[model samples]
Target: MICAPPEKIFRATRNRPALARERARLARAALADCRLCAHDCGVNRLAGETGLCHAGAEARFFSAQVEVSDELELMPTFSVALSGCDLRCDFCITGKESWNARAGLGFDSFQMAERAKLALQNGARTIMVLGGEPTIHLPSALEFVSLLPASAKLIWKTNAHGRTQARELLDGMFDVWLADFKFGNDACAQRLAKVSDYVRVVQENLLWADTHSELIVRHLLMPGHVECCWRPVAAWLAANLPGVKVNLRAGFWPAWHARRHGEFKNSLSVSENQFAFGLATELGLNLIP
Candidate 1:
Protein backbone atom coordinates (compact mmCIF):
# COMPACT_ATOMS: atom_id res chain seq x y z
CA MET A 1 0.00 0.00 0.00
CA ILE A 2 1.03 3.61 -0.45
CA CYS A 3 2.42 5.58 2.50
CA ALA A 4 -0.26 8.23 2.59
CA PRO A 5 -2.27 10.61 0.44
CA PRO A 6 -0.63 13.88 -0.55
CA GLU A 7 -3.29 15.80 1.33
CA LYS A 8 -2.43 13.97 4.55
CA ILE A 9 0.75 16.02 4.86
CA PHE A 10 0.48 19.54 6.31
CA ARG A 11 2.82 21.03 3.68
CA ALA A 12 1.10 19.54 0.62
CA THR A 13 0.31 22.94 -0.79
CA ARG A 14 3.96 24.00 -0.65
CA ASN A 15 5.52 20.98 -2.42
CA ARG A 16 5.90 22.79 -5.69
CA PRO A 17 8.67 24.06 -7.96
CA ALA A 18 8.54 27.59 -6.60
CA LEU A 19 8.70 26.39 -3.05
CA ALA A 20 11.63 24.12 -3.89
CA ARG A 21 13.49 26.99 -5.50
CA GLU A 22 12.80 29.26 -2.55
CA ARG A 23 14.02 26.61 -0.14
CA ALA A 24 17.07 25.98 -2.29
CA ARG A 25 17.87 29.68 -2.26
CA LEU A 26 17.58 29.82 1.50
CA ALA A 27 19.71 26.68 1.93
CA ARG A 28 22.37 28.00 -0.44
CA ALA A 29 22.63 31.18 1.59
CA ALA A 30 22.98 29.19 4.81
CA LEU A 31 26.44 28.09 3.68
CA ALA A 32 27.81 31.36 5.03
CA ASP A 33 26.92 30.37 8.58
CA CYS A 34 25.93 26.71 8.59
CA ARG A 35 23.52 25.49 11.24
CA LEU A 36 21.88 22.77 9.21
CA CYS A 37 22.89 19.98 11.60
CA ALA A 38 23.17 19.69 15.38
CA HIS A 39 26.95 20.12 15.08
CA ASP A 40 26.38 23.83 14.35
CA CYS A 41 30.05 24.26 13.39
CA GLY A 42 29.16 27.70 11.95
CA VAL A 43 31.74 27.19 9.22
CA ASN A 44 31.42 29.18 6.01
CA ARG A 45 31.19 26.47 3.40
CA LEU A 46 31.00 29.07 0.64
CA ALA A 47 34.53 30.12 1.60
CA GLY A 48 35.66 26.46 1.62
CA GLU A 49 35.43 26.21 5.41
CA THR A 50 34.64 22.64 6.33
CA GLY A 51 32.22 21.56 9.02
CA LEU A 52 31.61 18.16 10.59
CA CYS A 53 30.44 16.72 7.26
CA HIS A 54 33.41 18.19 5.36
CA ALA A 55 31.10 18.99 2.46
CA GLY A 56 31.67 22.20 0.55
CA ALA A 57 29.17 24.50 -1.17
CA GLU A 58 28.57 21.89 -3.87
CA ALA A 59 27.35 18.33 -3.32
CA ARG A 60 28.86 15.04 -4.42
CA PHE A 61 27.21 11.63 -4.80
CA PHE A 62 28.72 8.16 -4.55
CA SER A 63 25.90 6.03 -5.88
CA ALA A 64 22.62 6.36 -7.85
CA GLN A 65 20.56 3.38 -8.93
CA VAL A 66 17.11 1.85 -8.85
CA GLU A 67 16.98 -0.77 -6.12
CA VAL A 68 14.32 -2.99 -4.54
CA SER A 69 15.99 -3.07 -1.13
CA ASP A 70 13.86 -0.61 0.83
CA GLU A 71 10.48 -1.15 2.46
CA LEU A 72 7.98 -3.27 0.55
CA GLU A 73 5.72 -0.41 -0.46
CA LEU A 74 8.61 1.87 -1.42
CA MET A 75 10.75 -0.60 -3.35
CA PRO A 76 12.42 -0.15 -6.71
CA THR A 77 13.50 3.31 -5.64
CA PHE A 78 16.11 5.41 -7.36
CA SER A 79 18.41 5.84 -4.39
CA VAL A 80 20.90 8.69 -4.76
CA ALA A 81 23.48 8.44 -1.98
CA LEU A 82 25.34 11.70 -1.50
CA SER A 83 28.92 11.67 -0.22
CA GLY A 84 30.08 12.81 3.27
CA CYS A 85 28.12 12.61 6.50
CA ASP A 86 27.44 14.59 9.65
CA LEU A 87 28.00 11.58 11.89
CA ARG A 88 30.99 9.23 11.76
CA CYS A 89 29.38 5.89 12.51
CA ASP A 90 32.14 3.30 12.71
CA PHE A 91 29.82 0.54 11.60
CA CYS A 92 28.69 2.28 8.41
CA ILE A 93 28.57 -0.20 5.55
CA THR A 94 29.38 2.40 2.96
CA GLY A 95 32.06 4.14 4.97
CA LYS A 96 34.53 4.25 2.09
CA GLU A 97 32.25 6.66 0.27
CA SER A 98 30.16 8.07 3.10
CA TRP A 99 33.05 9.41 5.16
CA ASN A 100 34.92 11.04 2.28
CA ALA A 101 33.72 14.43 1.08
CA ARG A 102 35.23 14.25 -2.41
CA ALA A 103 34.69 10.60 -3.15
CA GLY A 104 32.42 10.77 -6.19
CA LEU A 105 31.11 12.65 -9.19
CA GLY A 106 29.73 16.15 -8.79
CA PHE A 107 25.96 16.36 -8.47
CA ASP A 108 23.95 17.80 -11.36
CA SER A 109 20.37 18.25 -10.30
CA PHE A 110 19.02 18.51 -13.85
CA GLN A 111 20.79 15.38 -15.05
CA MET A 112 20.10 13.37 -11.87
CA ALA A 113 16.42 14.30 -11.96
CA GLU A 114 16.22 13.16 -15.55
CA ARG A 115 17.83 9.86 -14.55
CA ALA A 116 15.31 9.51 -11.74
CA LYS A 117 12.51 10.16 -14.24
CA LEU A 118 13.84 7.33 -16.35
CA ALA A 119 13.93 5.05 -13.32
CA LEU A 120 10.33 5.97 -12.49
CA GLN A 121 9.36 5.04 -16.03
CA ASN A 122 11.26 1.76 -15.65
CA GLY A 123 9.35 0.41 -12.61
CA ALA A 124 10.84 2.53 -9.84
CA ARG A 125 8.21 3.42 -7.26
CA THR A 126 9.94 6.34 -5.55
CA ILE A 127 12.87 8.74 -5.87
CA MET A 128 14.96 8.61 -2.70
CA VAL A 129 17.44 11.33 -1.72
CA LEU A 130 19.80 9.86 0.86
CA GLY A 131 23.32 10.54 1.87
CA GLY A 132 25.98 10.08 4.00
CA GLU A 133 23.29 12.51 5.28
CA PRO A 134 21.38 14.83 2.94
CA THR A 135 20.83 17.52 5.57
CA ILE A 136 24.37 18.74 4.93
CA HIS A 137 23.66 19.25 1.25
CA LEU A 138 20.31 20.98 1.49
CA PRO A 139 20.84 23.32 -1.43
CA SER A 140 21.62 20.49 -3.87
CA ALA A 141 18.84 18.34 -2.50
CA LEU A 142 16.23 21.09 -2.90
CA GLU A 143 17.56 21.94 -6.34
CA PHE A 144 17.04 18.32 -7.34
CA VAL A 145 13.50 18.52 -6.01
CA SER A 146 12.87 21.62 -8.09
CA LEU A 147 13.86 19.69 -11.21
CA LEU A 148 11.71 16.66 -10.39
CA PRO A 149 8.11 16.28 -11.55
CA ALA A 150 5.57 17.55 -9.06
CA SER A 151 3.78 14.21 -8.98
CA ALA A 152 6.94 12.14 -8.41
CA LYS A 153 6.95 10.32 -5.08
CA LEU A 154 10.00 11.71 -3.32
CA ILE A 155 11.61 10.06 -0.29
CA TRP A 156 14.07 11.78 1.97
CA LYS A 157 16.16 9.04 3.61
CA THR A 158 18.10 10.65 6.42
CA ASN A 159 19.97 10.06 9.69
CA ALA A 160 17.47 12.41 11.41
CA HIS A 161 20.24 14.38 13.14
CA GLY A 162 19.32 17.69 11.53
CA ARG A 163 18.68 20.93 13.42
CA THR A 164 16.10 23.71 13.08
CA GLN A 165 17.48 25.31 9.92
CA ALA A 166 17.56 21.99 8.10
CA ARG A 167 13.98 21.24 9.11
CA GLU A 168 12.91 24.72 8.01
CA LEU A 169 14.41 24.12 4.57
CA LEU A 170 12.88 20.61 4.35
CA ASP A 171 9.42 21.42 5.77
CA GLY A 172 7.13 20.26 2.97
CA MET A 173 9.45 19.01 0.27
CA PHE A 174 9.31 15.21 0.36
CA ASP A 175 6.44 12.73 0.31
CA VAL A 176 8.11 10.28 2.72
CA TRP A 177 10.78 10.60 5.39
CA LEU A 178 12.68 7.32 5.68
CA ALA A 179 14.76 8.13 8.75
CA ASP A 180 17.15 6.18 10.99
CA PHE A 181 16.69 5.94 14.75
CA LYS A 182 19.88 3.98 15.33
CA PHE A 183 20.42 4.75 18.98
CA GLY A 184 17.82 4.97 21.74
CA ASN A 185 19.94 6.98 24.17
CA ASP A 186 22.62 9.64 24.16
CA ALA A 187 25.27 7.40 25.70
CA CYS A 188 25.18 4.81 22.92
CA ALA A 189 25.02 7.53 20.28
CA GLN A 190 28.02 9.37 21.64
CA ARG A 191 30.03 6.18 22.15
CA LEU A 192 29.21 4.70 18.74
CA ALA A 193 28.63 7.57 16.34
CA LYS A 194 30.49 10.38 18.06
CA VAL A 195 27.30 12.43 18.13
CA SER A 196 25.87 13.97 21.29
CA ASP A 197 22.20 14.68 22.05
CA TYR A 198 21.32 12.11 19.43
CA VAL A 199 18.05 10.94 20.95
CA ARG A 200 16.68 14.47 21.28
CA VAL A 201 17.72 15.43 17.75
CA VAL A 202 16.26 12.33 16.07
CA GLN A 203 13.02 12.45 18.04
CA GLU A 204 12.53 16.10 17.18
CA ASN A 205 13.12 15.40 13.50
CA LEU A 206 10.79 12.39 13.58
CA LEU A 207 8.03 14.44 15.19
CA TRP A 208 8.43 17.19 12.61
CA ALA A 209 8.57 14.67 9.75
CA ASP A 210 5.47 12.88 10.98
CA THR A 211 3.62 16.19 10.87
CA HIS A 212 5.02 17.32 7.49
CA SER A 213 5.20 14.04 5.58
CA GLU A 214 4.87 10.28 5.77
CA LEU A 215 7.51 9.04 8.21
CA ILE A 216 9.09 5.57 8.30
CA VAL A 217 11.45 4.92 11.20
CA ARG A 218 14.18 2.32 10.71
CA HIS A 219 16.36 1.01 13.51
CA LEU A 220 19.11 -1.44 12.63
CA LEU A 221 19.20 -4.03 15.40
CA MET A 222 22.85 -4.12 16.42
CA PRO A 223 24.59 -7.12 18.00
CA GLY A 224 24.99 -5.94 21.60
CA HIS A 225 22.64 -2.99 21.73
CA VAL A 226 19.27 -4.72 21.71
CA GLU A 227 18.30 -3.57 25.18
CA CYS A 228 20.18 -0.31 25.37
CA CYS A 229 19.23 0.95 21.90
CA TRP A 230 16.26 -0.89 20.38
CA ARG A 231 14.19 -1.24 23.54
CA PRO A 232 14.06 2.45 24.37
CA VAL A 233 13.53 3.34 20.71
CA ALA A 234 10.54 1.01 20.45
CA ALA A 235 9.11 2.20 23.75
CA TRP A 236 9.35 5.81 22.68
CA LEU A 237 7.73 5.11 19.34
CA ALA A 238 4.94 3.16 20.95
CA ALA A 239 4.24 5.91 23.46
CA ASN A 240 4.75 9.07 21.40
CA LEU A 241 3.97 7.86 17.87
CA PRO A 242 1.64 4.91 18.06
CA GLY A 243 0.93 3.22 14.71
CA VAL A 244 3.84 4.95 13.00
CA LYS A 245 5.49 2.49 10.57
CA VAL A 246 8.58 1.03 12.19
CA ASN A 247 11.06 -0.86 10.05
CA LEU A 248 12.91 -2.99 12.56
CA ARG A 249 15.83 -3.75 10.31
CA ALA A 250 17.48 -7.08 11.20
CA GLY A 251 20.41 -6.73 8.83
CA PHE A 252 23.39 -5.51 10.83
CA TRP A 253 26.80 -6.48 9.45
CA PRO A 254 30.21 -5.59 10.78
CA ALA A 255 31.56 -3.44 8.04
CA TRP A 256 33.99 -0.51 7.75
CA HIS A 257 35.69 0.26 11.03
CA ALA A 258 33.33 -1.89 13.01
CA ARG A 259 36.34 -3.92 14.12
CA ARG A 260 37.45 -0.89 16.07
CA HIS A 261 34.73 -1.59 18.61
CA GLY A 262 34.63 -4.91 20.47
CA GLU A 263 30.85 -5.26 20.28
CA PHE A 264 30.65 -4.39 16.57
CA LYS A 265 33.19 -6.99 15.51
CA ASN A 266 30.41 -9.39 14.58
CA SER A 267 26.95 -9.13 13.07
CA LEU A 268 23.79 -9.58 15.07
CA SER A 269 23.10 -13.12 16.14
CA VAL A 270 19.87 -15.03 15.53
CA SER A 271 18.98 -14.69 19.21
CA GLU A 272 19.59 -10.97 19.08
CA ASN A 273 17.27 -10.57 16.11
CA GLN A 274 14.55 -12.64 17.79
CA PHE A 275 14.94 -10.70 21.00
CA ALA A 276 14.72 -7.36 19.22
CA PHE A 277 11.55 -8.37 17.37
CA GLY A 278 10.05 -9.76 20.56
CA LEU A 279 10.68 -6.46 22.28
CA ALA A 280 9.15 -4.47 19.43
CA THR A 281 6.05 -6.66 19.56
CA GLU A 282 5.85 -6.24 23.30
CA LEU A 283 5.97 -2.48 22.88
CA GLY A 284 3.29 -2.69 20.14
CA LEU A 285 5.42 -1.04 17.49
CA ASN A 286 4.03 -1.16 13.98
CA LEU A 287 6.77 -3.28 12.45
CA ILE A 288 6.97 -3.38 8.66
CA PRO A 289 9.37 -5.09 6.26
Candidate 2:
Protein backbone atom coordinates (compact mmCIF):
# COMPACT_ATOMS: atom_id res chain seq x y z
CA MET A 1 0.00 0.00 0.00
CA ILE A 2 1.18 3.52 -0.85
CA CYS A 3 1.38 5.77 2.18
CA ALA A 4 0.24 9.40 2.21
CA PRO A 5 2.94 12.00 2.60
CA PRO A 6 3.42 13.87 5.85
CA GLU A 7 1.82 17.32 6.10
CA LYS A 8 3.85 20.43 5.43
CA ILE A 9 3.11 22.84 8.25
CA PHE A 10 4.02 26.07 6.43
CA ARG A 11 1.15 25.45 3.98
CA ALA A 12 -1.24 26.55 6.70
CA THR A 13 0.22 30.07 6.55
CA ARG A 14 0.07 30.35 2.74
CA ASN A 15 -3.11 32.43 2.65
CA ARG A 16 -2.64 34.12 6.01
CA PRO A 17 -1.21 37.52 5.15
CA ALA A 18 -1.76 38.85 8.66
CA LEU A 19 0.20 35.96 10.21
CA ALA A 20 3.16 36.67 7.94
CA ARG A 21 3.09 40.36 8.80
CA GLU A 22 2.96 39.62 12.52
CA ARG A 23 5.87 37.18 12.23
CA ALA A 24 7.85 39.77 10.29
CA ARG A 25 7.28 42.27 13.10
CA LEU A 26 8.43 39.77 15.70
CA ALA A 27 11.51 38.89 13.67
CA ARG A 28 12.47 42.55 13.40
CA ALA A 29 11.99 43.04 17.12
CA ALA A 30 14.24 40.05 17.86
CA LEU A 31 16.89 41.46 15.56
CA ALA A 32 16.95 44.74 17.43
CA ASP A 33 18.65 43.07 20.39
CA CYS A 34 20.34 40.40 18.23
CA ARG A 35 20.10 37.50 20.68
CA LEU A 36 19.05 35.12 17.91
CA CYS A 37 22.10 32.85 18.00
CA ALA A 38 23.89 31.15 20.90
CA HIS A 39 26.48 33.92 21.12
CA ASP A 40 23.92 36.29 22.66
CA CYS A 41 26.06 39.30 21.82
CA GLY A 42 23.15 41.58 22.73
CA VAL A 43 24.38 44.22 20.35
CA ASN A 44 21.77 46.75 19.40
CA ARG A 45 21.95 46.11 15.66
CA LEU A 46 19.29 48.80 15.10
CA ALA A 47 21.83 51.32 16.49
CA GLY A 48 24.49 50.25 13.96
CA GLU A 49 26.47 48.25 16.52
CA THR A 50 28.10 45.02 15.39
CA GLY A 51 28.13 41.80 17.41
CA LEU A 52 30.31 38.67 17.43
CA CYS A 53 28.69 37.46 14.24
CA HIS A 54 29.53 40.92 12.77
CA ALA A 55 26.03 41.29 11.33
CA GLY A 56 24.62 44.81 11.26
CA ALA A 57 20.94 45.77 11.19
CA GLU A 58 20.35 44.39 7.69
CA ALA A 59 20.76 40.85 6.32
CA ARG A 60 23.58 40.01 3.93
CA PHE A 61 23.77 37.18 1.38
CA PHE A 62 26.78 35.85 -0.47
CA SER A 63 24.94 34.04 -3.26
CA ALA A 64 21.84 32.20 -4.41
CA GLN A 65 21.87 29.40 -6.99
CA VAL A 66 20.10 26.33 -8.29
CA GLU A 67 22.01 23.46 -6.74
CA VAL A 68 21.61 19.86 -7.90
CA SER A 69 24.17 18.38 -5.48
CA ASP A 70 22.48 18.49 -2.12
CA GLU A 71 20.98 15.87 0.18
CA LEU A 72 18.77 13.43 -1.77
CA GLU A 73 15.79 14.55 0.25
CA LEU A 74 16.43 18.20 -0.75
CA MET A 75 17.68 17.80 -4.29
CA PRO A 76 16.96 20.06 -7.29
CA THR A 77 16.72 23.01 -4.96
CA PHE A 78 17.30 26.74 -4.97
CA SER A 79 19.89 27.38 -2.29
CA VAL A 80 20.32 30.79 -0.68
CA ALA A 81 23.65 31.29 1.16
CA LEU A 82 23.32 33.95 3.79
CA SER A 83 26.29 35.64 5.47
CA GLY A 84 27.56 35.56 9.10
CA CYS A 85 28.19 32.44 11.19
CA ASP A 86 27.71 31.95 14.92
CA LEU A 87 30.51 29.38 15.22
CA ARG A 88 33.95 29.54 13.65
CA CYS A 89 34.60 25.91 12.70
CA ASP A 90 38.15 25.20 11.66
CA PHE A 91 37.26 23.29 8.50
CA CYS A 92 34.61 25.58 7.08
CA ILE A 93 34.27 24.84 3.34
CA THR A 94 32.71 28.20 2.48
CA GLY A 95 35.84 29.92 3.92
CA LYS A 96 36.19 33.17 5.88
CA GLU A 97 34.02 35.26 3.57
CA SER A 98 30.82 33.45 4.55
CA TRP A 99 31.56 33.83 8.25
CA ASN A 100 32.32 37.51 7.87
CA ALA A 101 29.10 39.52 7.71
CA ARG A 102 30.96 42.48 6.21
CA ALA A 103 31.92 40.58 3.04
CA GLY A 104 28.66 39.67 1.25
CA LEU A 105 26.28 41.61 -0.95
CA GLY A 106 23.51 43.08 1.15
CA PHE A 107 19.77 42.71 0.45
CA ASP A 108 16.57 43.31 2.36
CA SER A 109 13.90 40.64 2.85
CA PHE A 110 11.78 41.95 -0.04
CA GLN A 111 14.70 41.70 -2.44
CA MET A 112 15.43 38.13 -1.28
CA ALA A 113 11.75 37.30 -1.71
CA GLU A 114 11.88 38.49 -5.31
CA ARG A 115 14.97 36.36 -5.94
CA ALA A 116 13.28 33.31 -4.39
CA LYS A 117 10.19 33.84 -6.53
CA LEU A 118 12.39 33.93 -9.62
CA ALA A 119 14.04 30.65 -8.63
CA LEU A 120 10.63 29.06 -8.10
CA GLN A 121 9.58 30.16 -11.57
CA ASN A 122 12.78 28.61 -12.94
CA GLY A 123 11.69 25.12 -11.68
CA ALA A 124 13.22 24.97 -8.22
CA ARG A 125 11.14 22.68 -6.01
CA THR A 126 12.71 23.47 -2.63
CA ILE A 127 13.97 26.74 -1.19
CA MET A 128 16.99 25.90 1.01
CA VAL A 129 18.20 28.51 3.50
CA LEU A 130 21.91 27.88 4.13
CA GLY A 131 24.70 30.02 5.44
CA GLY A 132 27.84 30.57 7.38
CA GLU A 133 25.07 29.78 9.85
CA PRO A 134 21.70 31.19 8.83
CA THR A 135 20.55 31.33 12.45
CA ILE A 136 22.78 34.38 12.97
CA HIS A 137 20.53 36.32 10.59
CA LEU A 138 17.29 34.95 12.01
CA PRO A 139 15.06 37.94 11.33
CA SER A 140 15.95 38.24 7.66
CA ALA A 141 15.75 34.47 7.19
CA LEU A 142 12.24 34.46 8.65
CA GLU A 143 11.13 37.31 6.40
CA PHE A 144 12.64 35.60 3.36
CA VAL A 145 10.83 32.31 4.07
CA SER A 146 7.58 34.16 4.64
CA LEU A 147 7.85 35.64 1.15
CA LEU A 148 8.53 32.32 -0.58
CA PRO A 149 5.92 30.66 -2.82
CA ALA A 150 3.87 28.21 -0.76
CA SER A 151 4.37 25.50 -3.39
CA ALA A 152 8.09 25.29 -2.59
CA LYS A 153 9.17 23.52 0.59
CA LEU A 154 11.40 25.43 3.05
CA ILE A 155 14.59 23.57 4.02
CA TRP A 156 16.70 25.21 6.72
CA LYS A 157 20.40 24.23 6.84
CA THR A 158 21.49 25.38 10.25
CA ASN A 159 24.29 24.79 12.78
CA ALA A 160 21.67 24.20 15.49
CA HIS A 161 23.18 26.90 17.74
CA GLY A 162 20.05 29.02 17.64
CA ARG A 163 18.76 30.59 20.84
CA THR A 164 15.27 30.08 22.30
CA GLN A 165 14.16 33.40 20.85
CA ALA A 166 15.26 32.27 17.41
CA ARG A 167 13.26 29.05 17.77
CA GLU A 168 10.16 31.01 18.80
CA LEU A 169 10.50 33.18 15.70
CA LEU A 170 10.85 30.13 13.42
CA ASP A 171 8.19 27.95 15.03
CA GLY A 172 5.64 26.52 12.56
CA MET A 173 7.42 28.17 9.60
CA PHE A 174 9.91 25.62 8.30
CA ASP A 175 9.03 22.44 6.40
CA VAL A 176 12.35 20.66 7.01
CA TRP A 177 15.24 21.39 9.35
CA LEU A 178 18.73 20.23 8.31
CA ALA A 179 20.52 20.45 11.62
CA ASP A 180 24.32 20.12 11.58
CA PHE A 181 25.35 18.58 14.86
CA LYS A 182 29.10 19.13 14.67
CA PHE A 183 30.33 17.87 18.01
CA GLY A 184 29.19 15.38 20.64
CA ASN A 185 31.41 16.53 23.45
CA ASP A 186 32.07 20.01 24.80
CA ALA A 187 35.88 19.67 24.69
CA CYS A 188 35.92 18.82 20.99
CA ALA A 189 33.52 21.65 20.22
CA GLN A 190 35.62 24.10 22.21
CA ARG A 191 38.72 22.98 20.37
CA LEU A 192 37.24 23.03 16.89
CA ALA A 193 34.57 25.73 16.98
CA LYS A 194 35.63 27.77 20.04
CA VAL A 195 32.25 27.22 21.64
CA SER A 196 32.31 26.04 25.27
CA ASP A 197 28.63 25.18 25.71
CA TYR A 198 28.15 23.67 22.28
CA VAL A 199 26.75 20.34 23.48
CA ARG A 200 23.90 21.76 25.55
CA VAL A 201 22.91 24.46 23.09
CA VAL A 202 22.81 22.25 20.00
CA GLN A 203 21.10 19.36 21.79
CA GLU A 204 18.45 21.61 23.30
CA ASN A 205 17.82 23.40 20.02
CA LEU A 206 17.62 20.15 18.03
CA LEU A 207 15.27 18.54 20.54
CA TRP A 208 13.03 21.60 20.39
CA ALA A 209 13.08 21.70 16.58
CA ASP A 210 12.20 18.00 16.30
CA THR A 211 8.86 18.71 17.94
CA HIS A 212 7.86 21.43 15.44
CA SER A 213 9.48 20.45 12.15
CA GLU A 214 10.54 17.53 9.96
CA LEU A 215 14.02 17.15 11.45
CA ILE A 216 17.04 15.67 9.68
CA VAL A 217 20.25 15.55 11.67
CA ARG A 218 23.51 15.76 9.67
CA HIS A 219 26.90 14.79 11.06
CA LEU A 220 30.04 15.33 9.00
CA LEU A 221 32.59 12.75 10.14
CA MET A 222 35.76 14.69 10.79
CA PRO A 223 39.18 13.04 10.72
CA GLY A 224 40.44 11.80 14.12
CA HIS A 225 37.40 13.00 16.05
CA VAL A 226 34.86 10.25 15.45
CA GLU A 227 35.14 8.76 18.89
CA CYS A 228 34.67 12.15 20.52
CA CYS A 229 31.90 13.32 18.23
CA TRP A 230 30.18 10.68 16.08
CA ARG A 231 29.81 7.95 18.67
CA PRO A 232 28.35 10.22 21.33
CA VAL A 233 26.03 11.84 18.82
CA ALA A 234 24.78 8.47 17.58
CA ALA A 235 24.27 7.28 21.14
CA TRP A 236 22.30 10.39 22.01
CA LEU A 237 20.07 10.10 18.95
CA ALA A 238 19.39 6.41 19.55
CA ALA A 239 18.49 7.03 23.16
CA ASN A 240 16.63 10.32 22.95
CA LEU A 241 15.57 10.92 19.35
CA PRO A 242 14.73 7.48 18.04
CA GLY A 243 13.09 7.39 14.57
CA VAL A 244 14.58 10.81 13.68
CA LYS A 245 16.38 10.62 10.33
CA VAL A 246 20.14 11.22 10.27
CA ASN A 247 22.63 11.75 7.45
CA LEU A 248 26.05 10.25 8.20
CA ARG A 249 28.20 12.26 5.85
CA ALA A 250 31.62 10.90 4.79
CA GLY A 251 32.59 13.97 2.78
CA PHE A 252 35.09 15.67 5.04
CA TRP A 253 37.81 17.54 3.21
CA PRO A 254 40.35 19.66 5.06
CA ALA A 255 39.79 23.23 3.90
CA TRP A 256 40.16 26.86 4.96
CA HIS A 257 41.89 27.07 8.37
CA ALA A 258 41.75 23.33 8.88
CA ARG A 259 45.39 23.09 7.87
CA ARG A 260 46.32 25.11 10.91
CA HIS A 261 45.22 22.26 13.17
CA GLY A 262 47.34 19.13 12.87
CA GLU A 263 44.47 16.70 13.41
CA PHE A 264 42.23 18.43 10.84
CA LYS A 265 44.85 18.61 8.08
CA ASN A 266 43.65 15.43 6.36
CA SER A 267 40.44 14.00 4.92
CA LEU A 268 38.43 11.20 6.49
CA SER A 269 39.96 7.74 5.88
CA VAL A 270 38.01 4.80 4.42
CA SER A 271 38.27 2.95 7.71
CA GLU A 272 36.96 5.94 9.65
CA ASN A 273 33.97 6.23 7.33
CA GLN A 274 33.20 2.55 7.74
CA PHE A 275 33.49 2.83 11.49
CA ALA A 276 31.11 5.78 11.58
CA PHE A 277 28.54 3.99 9.47
CA GLY A 278 28.92 0.83 11.52
CA LEU A 279 28.37 2.78 14.72
CA ALA A 280 25.25 4.32 13.28
CA THR A 281 23.95 0.89 12.32
CA GLU A 282 24.70 -0.49 15.76
CA LEU A 283 22.82 2.40 17.33
CA GLY A 284 19.76 1.64 15.19
CA LEU A 285 19.51 5.08 13.62
CA ASN A 286 17.31 5.80 10.61
CA LEU A 287 20.14 6.92 8.32
CA ILE A 288 19.66 8.61 4.97
CA PRO A 289 22.15 8.27 2.14
List per-prediction Cα lDDT, in the order shown.
0.91, 0.82
lDDT of 1: 0.91
Give all TM-scores, in the order shown: 0.95, 0.93
Per-candidate clash tally: 0, 0
Name the weakest run of 10 consecutive residues (lDDT summed) in model 2.
8-17
What RMSD does each model have against the real structure?
3.0, 2.4
Model 2: per-residue Cα lDDT at residue 274: 91
Off by over 4 Å in 2: 1-12, 15-18
Q: Between which residue pairs do clashes occur in model 2?
A: none
